[model samples]
Target: MRTLRKYAGPLSDRRFRLLWAGQGVSTAGDAAMLVALSLALVSSTGSASALGFVLAATAVPRLLLTLVGGVWADRLPRQKVMLAADAVNLVAQVGIGVELLGTVDVGLVAVYAAASGAAAAFFVPASGAIVPSTVAPEHLARANALVALTRQIAMVAGPALATALVVTIGAPWVFFLNAGTFAVSAVTLALLRVPAVAAVRTGFWDELRQGWREFSGRRWFWTNATAHICWNLGRSAYQVLGPLVAVRQLGGELSWGLIAQGAAIGAVGGAVVALHVRPRRPLVVANLALALGAVPLVLLAVAAAPVVIALAAGVMHAGLSVMQVIWQTTVQNHVPEHALSRVLAYDWLGSLALAPLGLALAGPLADRIGLPATLAGAAVLLAGGCLLVLAVPEVRRIGSRPHQDLPTAEE
Candidate 1:
């Protein structure tokens, strides 16, 4: 009874329902973009480094501007920020679509990717806060679960669909279709009636300093944030390397889609598991769960076979999904509502700090050394990163109860 009710309660809320449905459509488009972009780069250049360049172009801007996004999300109406981000993304997508349809300029595609990344930095921080703003605190865990579920379902369908379209009609139309989804997302946010919560109009730097204090002041917080940084570096490497190998050795876009779809199927199961079981030491479990991510990267490097690699991806993503839920719920419940977006921004900044560097380096290094060796090193670093985070006593002991206000921001 409790299990069913917990899942159904958030969906019953009209506002959450609208946000949930709209986000589902948007996520599918994102998944499709992932497939289309990778295939487009590989098909055009046949160079792994070219693919990495585009990925790096996207990550660099996000890393640079994410803090500014954090400040705005905390100060202004979050839904409005999201709407603006969506509008920016919508225009960027159209640019990419037009460029793809006419003359394929790799440099031009990369520029658009950077623009989209800047918009995403703002979208992500605002999006992170909206759930806590809209849903009851008690139901936040379940609400995140539903969000994960929708995203996972899209992951299952979108890649397969993308590969089919890319194989037949080509990448430009797939990109144009993605532009339409952004329109859907913009419409939903325009209608969203977020409860108006007053924000402090602190000087911009002070807000960042305060958020930094709130974030770095907590030992568990900083430790987990560091862990995320390491994990992202390794994960970005895998994302760039994985698709190239799939297209070259495994069997092209269809195989890439299969591996992605398998991960999505597994992620759905993990999300369902998260909806029911709230771990007492969520940070500890999440850290251990992250260690599982190393497996698929190792599999891809060693096997390079579709069936085997897809199965490994499934196991890896199941753990990834659960860890994501636990981490989000922990942060949302712990941070002060007024400063939540800024703190979340710091968390994002800290976690993704090295991703651009990793994405930039992964291809060039792999070309020089060897793909298998590069992947194996990443897997080793990924596991080592997880264990180091687990070594922190604070992360291991993080309790289920909320810690809304830390004892001291300076401590």
Candidate 2:
């Protein structure tokens, strides 16, 4: 019973509950939107290039504006920034749905994608920064775990739901449904009574520079961020090559799907574990856990059986899920409240910056060398990078406590 309460403790806070519920729905909606968009594009244009262009359209604005968005999130009320983002997404999804209902216009879809991406740039940092305001300090880890669980669940179920809905009610309605989910999120944000955070108004560029300084000053943070970049790069190998290998060697799409399901289930389980465990040296533990991500890459490279690869994938993602929860909680606890969003924005940018490059290069690298060799190299790099981050004393020294005496950018 105590264990149950520990897992459920975050929900006791009304604000956290609202935030969690809204994000849960919103995340699932976003996942569904991805499927609906792809189907709509393929059905209309029959051009993979168009699909890729529209997808890139979303990423370009996000990459360009993420830092600016982070600064704004710090300057403004995080909740308000989120609300505005929700509104923008609602409009964009609606536009996409309406257009799909008529004729799928690639240009308009790209425009909507850009708008949504820009909104996400603002929304993500605010969302991460706002969590500390919603839940108690003691419950922060569990809260993060809960949020991670929601995302994992959504990743698994959302696509299935979208696929079903697309077949039944059509892609337009799926977009419309996604719009409604955003509305739900907006209403929740509107209702939230977040504790006021004192805004530090400064020159936008100055604030961005300050954020960079804060991010770079923390040895633990930057080292971990660097590791995360390498981690993402390595993981992209499996993402790009996994399906191809599965089809060629294993059994086809079904095997790939099972592997994905294994990861999702592992992620869910990892979040559950995170809710209960509080490691003293969070970064140390997180790095150790994240090293497990390389297992699947190694297994895939060796031409392991589907079940074996799936199990390795499960272990890998479970570790990732735990690492995510610990990383978020540690950042929230250590970073000063005023600069948290900006710092988080830097983290977000650094973590994702190399992923596209990795995705692009993975296929070429595999072609040049061999699939097994490329996968093995990525696995080694992923595991080695994670373990190497542990050599930073700060990473090993940081504790689970909130508000550690860490230096700020101003210092």
- Candidate 1 contains a number of clashing pairs equal to 0
Candidate 2 per-residue lDDT over residues 273-392, each given as its tens digit: 887779999999999999999999998998899999999899999999999999999999998888999999998897667799999999999999999999999999899999999998
Find the 10 residues in a row with the least total lDDT in model 2. 402-411
Candidate 1 regions with alpha-carbon error over 4 angstroms: 1-3, 38-56, 105-109, 167-170, 236-262, 296-310, 359-380, 403-411
User: In model 1, what is the error at residue 340, expressed in angstroms?
Assistant: 1.7
lDDT of each: 0.84, 0.91
lDDT of 1 by residue, 315-400 (tens): 78888888899999998877777787888898888767877689889999899999999998889888788888878776777676
lDDT of 1 at 378: 89
Q: What's each prediction's TM-score?
A: 0.84, 0.98
- The ten-residue window of minimal lDDT in model 1 covers 402-411
Residue 395, candidate 1: Cα error in Å is 2.4
> Model 1, 155: alpha-carbon shift in Å?
2.4
